[model samples]
Every structure is written in C-alpha cells, then in structure tokens.
Target: MLTAVMQCVFRILPAVWVLLACLGGASAQDYEAGFKAFQAGNYAQARGIWRPLADAGDAQAQYGLGVMYERGAGAIAADLGRAAHWYARAVGQGHPSAQNNLGLMFAQGRGVQRAPVRATKLWQSAAEAGHLMAQYNLGLAYYRGEGLERDNKTALRWFRRAARSGLPDGQYAMGQMYRLGVVVAQDNAKALAWYRRAAAQGHGKAESLAQALADDGWEAAKLDVPATGDAKVEASPVVPKQQAVGRASPDGSVRSAERSSPAGSGTTGSGQGVRADAARIWLGSLRTRAKARQHWRDMLRRFPEALRGASPSYSEVDLGDNGTFYRVLAVGYPHPEAAGRACQTLRAREPSAFCKVMAGGN
Candidate 1:
C-alpha cells in the first residue's frame, strides 16, 4: 500500500528541466500519451508506448516505466529489480521525483540493499529541488538522526517548508509538534488549524485528531501567534480561515491540484484551498507563504492607498524539484480593471515591486 501510494508522487522533475524540455532542451519525443493510457487503466498500452521511449533515453518515460514495473501495472509482472534500474536511469537524468521514490526503495530495502545513508542523500537531493514528500522525509530523518546528525532546528525548517506547501504528512507533523509542545510552543489553536488542514487532505490520523479537537471546542483558527518562550518558537504556517483543501484528482495524482494552481488558478499550496478570486493583485512568488504575510504587511505600511481594497491570501506555486513559492495576492478587487489599476498605482510608486492584476472568481 505504501508503494502504491508513493506512486501518487511520481514525477517531481525540476521546472527548469520541464521548461528546457519544452524549449528543445531534451528529446521532443512525446510520452504524455503513455501517461494518458496509464490514467485510463490501459496498462498494456502504457507499457508498449513507454518501452521504446524509455529505452531511447526519455527520462520521463523511464520514470513512468519504473513506476509501472513497481506496481506491476503493465503486461509484465512485478519486477522490483527492473523498477530500480529504470528509476536509476531517470535519476541520472536529474529526475527529482525518481530520486525521491528510489530513495524510499533504498530505505525500505525493496529492490536495493537497505542503505539509510543513501536514502537520506537521495532525499536531500530531491528535497532541495522542492519535492514536498522528500522534504518531509528528510525532515523526519533529521529529527531522528537517521543516517545523519540530529538537528531539530534543521528538521523544523524542513517540516515547515513542507507543511507550508500543504503536504499532509508535514502538516500532521506540525500538529504533533504543537500538540506535544516539543520543539514549538504549545498552542492548541495552531495545532487545530494544522490538524484540520491535514485531515482535509485525507490523512486518517489527522482526521481522528481534528474530530477530537473539535469535540474539545477548537474551531478553524486564524494565525495563532504563540508567545515565544526560552526557545524562539515561530508560529505554524498560515492557512487562511477560508481555505478549503481540494479533493484528490480523478487521475489519482496527489499533487495534480498543486500543478494547476500556479497557472493563474489562484489556489494555494499542494492541495490546499479553494481558488481565491478576491486575491487579485499577485505580488509575485516568494519562497514561503509566511513571507507573503510579511510582504503584505510591508506593502500596507509603505503604500496604504495603493492597496485600496485588498484582502490577504496567496497563490502557491509548487515547482516539483525547483521548489515551492507563494504569490502574495491581494484580494477584494471587484474586477480586472480595478485590480489592474491598484497594481498600476503600486508599480508607479515602487518600480521594483512585483504586482500583477489577477482577476477574481466566484
């Protein structure tokens, strides 16, 4: 079941590589047809279409075949050895998702020998590229000192990074930390918020905990800025009170919603939130959504009139291995013209600030 679920996170290739591939950076041979077939459950056709492409050195195809073999989805029976081979090929070509999945294989001693160090190294590579699962896994490794030195600070950083992107595992971890009052300050409000987010994403443990929290009278929370104690504890990632987690895609890819959100969808994070149309002025992508809040505050103080009618929210951009960034969007504009005018005014005032008019939705 774990292997099957990991298939949902199969393609974490870097955005630059995807861009390069689009701009003739790699072989132009089409492989999406195979993906379509797989999505349609035509495993035989997917295998047939992928074999030649995989053999011809198409990294994406190689990764697909690796996944197909791992799942025994095609005409061929389950072949862990072959799956590892294909994953290795894709990894050699800088496929971040393949690196992450293969790292799991190493960690579990499935196709390859158990090598926690190797697994951690692969996870580090993928995590650095913005693979949310990899980031979570690497954070766990850091928390445990698994094949690496234990660094709670580093672990917290990675966990927050993954959680900010709305990874269920990472969000759950955040909830646990807050609930336990371990690394972070104990804040039930923040814990409840994180739990609700993870629970909405179909995390079973989170669902159970969320129900418990609600029964205990906790509600969907605002940013619960906890007091800093001896240890400098920051608040959990801000998930707006209105954000609704997207349902999983029909294609069964866990990150599909995330993939589409950045292309002007106005949604935020991996699978978190409804498309917020009130958020019209896109302030450009920053490394974290936390930064979006800070940026918004900065803009409000610097140019109050320029942001005449705007709310606080963001559109998340998850770039597989390229990393995740949040586009700070100011909500409450009535139309494109109004939003455009606001952005234009802001631009006129601060020439370097990135401000784009993103129209609203229902």
Candidate 2:
C-alpha cells in the first residue's frame, strides 16, 4: 500500500507543477494566454489577463496594455493619455518596443508635446538596441535633418543596417537610393538587385522597380577587371607643379597634379621593401564625375611622362549615404607588377606623390 501511494504522489507532482505555472509561469502560461486572447479579438479578456501582471511591473504586459489603450481594443475607448502612461511605465523598464512606440507619439505630439529632439533620443536608444523600425526611423531623421544635422553618411549606415535586418521599408529605401544615385553611383544592376529583394517580400514599389529594370534588359556584370599580361612601363617621371592642386569637392577630396593626393593627407608607408603588384594605380576618389575628370587632367599635366599614354577614365562606386564617388585611375602599365614598381619608384622619388596601387576595383 505505501509503495503504491508514493507512485501516485510522484505522478501527481507533475500535474501540480503545471497548475502552478499557469498561475504565473515557470511556463509563462498567463502571458501567452493574454496574447492569444488579444489575437482572438477578446480585448477585454486580454486586458484583464494582462492588468494583474502589468500592475506587478511586467514590462511586456505594460506594453500590451499601452497598445490596448492606444488602439481602443476590446471596448477600451482609445485613450492616448492612458496609452502614454502605460508606455512610459514600460519604457521606464527599458523596453525597446515601448521606446519606439513612445518615440512615435512624441514625434507626432499625439499624447505628448511635439519634440523632435526627444523623439530622436528615444529612437536612437531603441535603434542601438537593434529595433528595426527604430533604426529605420533614425535613418529618416538623419536623412531629413530632423532633430539633428543632416548627415548622409550616418543616414546610410542606419538604412543599411535596417535593410540588412529584412525590413521591407528599409529595403525599398535602399533600392531607391541605388536607382537614383542619391549617395552612391547609379548602377542599374545593383538597383535591380535591391529592388528584387524587396519585391520578394511583397514590397509594391520594389515590385514595379524590379519589373522596370527587367524590362530594360539589365544584366549583372563583373565588378572588377581580371588581371592581364605584364604591362609596359614607358612614362618618365616629371616634376609636379605647385599650381596643379585640384579644386576641392564637396566631400573634401582633392586631386593634386601629381595625382592620388587627398587634402591634408600624409604619405602612406613606403612598400619599397615589399613586392608590389599594381597593374593599375589610384589617383583619387572624387565627389563628382566632372571633378574626377578635372583631377585626371591635372594628373596628366603634373606627370606628363608618368602618364604619357594613359587616357583619363574613372570607375564609379556608390558609398551609400556617404555619397557616390568616382575613382580616377592612371594606368598604362604592362601589368600590375610594373604599375606597383612605378608607384614604389614614384613614392621613393617624391614623398608627396602619395602613390598607391589600386588594391582592386569595386
């Protein structure tokens, strides 16, 4: 009889443990129950289920209550004041969603005073915590110069982060930037790639853009040129003129007559001891195509012998929010090895030449 009783008690223990979890949860049964009730349109049931936990300082419950008040779900009249109250409670506990929602409220002055600065601060806090919407909002803020200095670079960084996280809106924004060459150089192939990604997720604008690019018969191309046979080096080094300093572009890049000179840039380490294999060399990455072309002309004048047979050409690249730039390369080498030798020789000959081999193209 004693052995049988002990067996029954052991079996009963699991049931008792389950019952205990439903009340508060080592199983989190109540919170889940509230969510199900809310989804089922039983707003009252959800609110009732959440209130106790909310009063006991559960952040998720507080956020749920805030939503309920804001949306007026389940017979609860929409109350922005109450919503703000609950959101403030959740935000006090550092809830990211609550922070983002409250930021919206602050931005629109719904239940709070309109404050762009406040909204931005809240968005930044939530954004840094990896909240996708917050990241997107922050990107817009920077893009539009709202509550902060307009910084295309910062905006691009945030937009890239949000897009990489699979936000459809962010993906669409990236596609637009690519298509329009807002910051990066316009590349239809890349624009189509981004648009297609968004379209796969049912982004309407992206769908149309992707279709348009497809209609245009755009095809992806290799971004880099392959290495070729040894290049002939024939250009003689010449004296660089002081008057050949190129005009400053908006992004602060300047091309010198000697080429590859950025304003306030110091000489990179001399790789004289190391083998260099530069088939091509970089002159400067300038803001605009015209600026790059001007720099190339300056280079030709500055290094007549060094660029004897070289023609002016530039490669375009989009740096997202940092903006689009064109890299003007000075080339005529038999091969990269020759180019590398020339760059090394130039650097050795004139420390101010700032000669650097193109590591590779983008």
- Which sections of candidate 2 miss by over 4 Å? 1-27, 220-362
List, residue by residue over 226-277, the lDDT tens digit for candidate 2.
1010011111122110111122233322222122221111122233544322
Candidate 2: lDDT of 219? 53
How accurate locally, in lDDT, is each candidate? 0.58, 0.56
Cα displacement (Å) at residue 330, model 1: 30
Model 1, residue 147: distance off in Å is 2.0
Count of backbone collisions in candidate 1: 4
Q: Against the true structure, whose TM-score is highest?
A: 1
Q: List the residue pairs that clash in candidate 1.
A: 129-321, 278-331, 279-331, 311-331
The TM-scores, one per candidate, come to 0.55, 0.53
Candidate 1 runs further than 4 Å off: 1-29, 218-221, 224-362
